[model samples]
Target: MKLKVDYKKCEKAGECYYNHNALFERTDNGFPKILVEDLTTDALRHEAAEAIEVCPTGAITIEE
Candidate 1:
């Protein structure tokens, strides 16, 4: 599985990057920059889920 973010649905809330920095980074414009595309481990998958749940706009999802 991989973590995917829908840019059109994102509102730059910073929740993904702020809480899940291992998988994301903050762009200069405050948008989230995905640091990992692949959910290579159970840890990563769990982290991605947390990020997705925290996203207010529900922009993050798991791409299987």
Candidate 2:
């Protein structure tokens, strides 16, 4: 699975990083930075999904 982020739609809410710090990180400017681009495990996939759901702007998407 691949994770895609729509920067234009992002609000810099930091919810993604708060929910799943292992998969997402915060940049110096307070935007989200994907720590794991490719979801290779079940745990990672689930975590990514949670991050997507938690994102207020719906900026994150999963590509399978």
Candidate 3:
């Protein structure tokens, strides 16, 4: 699986970073930066899905 972000649609809510710091990081301006690209492990896939769901702007997407 792959994780993608729509930067234009991102609201910088920080939910993904807050919930999954290992997979996502917050920029100085508070935007979410993806720490990992391809989710090769099951754990990462699950976490990515959770982040996508928590994102209020629906900016995060999972490509399977």
Candidate 4:
């Protein structure tokens, strides 16, 4: 699976970080920091979907 966060639409609510710190984090400016790109692991796929669901700003998307 492929994952990408739209920084332009992101509100930096930190839901992604709260759920998976190992996969996501917040920058010093409060924006989301995606640790992995183009994830192939099952764990990462689940986590990325979670992040997309939890993102309040609708900034996350998954690509197959």
lDDT tens digits, residue span 1-64, model 1: 9789999999999999999999999999989999999999999999999998999999999998
Cα lDDT tens digits, model 4, 1-64, are: 7778888998888888888787788889888787887788888888888888888999988877
**Residue pairs with clashing backbones, model 2:** none
lDDT of all predictions = 0.94, 0.90, 0.91, 0.83
Residue 2, candidate 1: how far off, in angstroms? 1.2
**Model 2 residue-pair collision total:** 0
TM-score of 2: 0.93
lDDT of 2 by residue, 1-64 (tens): 8988899999999999887899888999988889999999999999988988899998999998
TM-scores of the candidates in the order shown: 0.97, 0.93, 0.93, 0.86
Candidate 2 overall lDDT versus native: 0.90
lDDT of 3 by residue, 1-64 (tens): 8898899999999999999887899999988889998999989998898998899999999887
Clashes of 3: 0
Model 2 lDDT-worst window of ten: 16-25
lDDT value, candidate 3, whole model:
0.91
- After best superposition, candidate 2 residue 22: deviation in angstroms? 0.4
> After superposition, which runs of candidate 2 have C-alpha atoms over 4 Å from their true positions?
none
Cα deviation of 6 in candidate 4 (Å)? 0.7
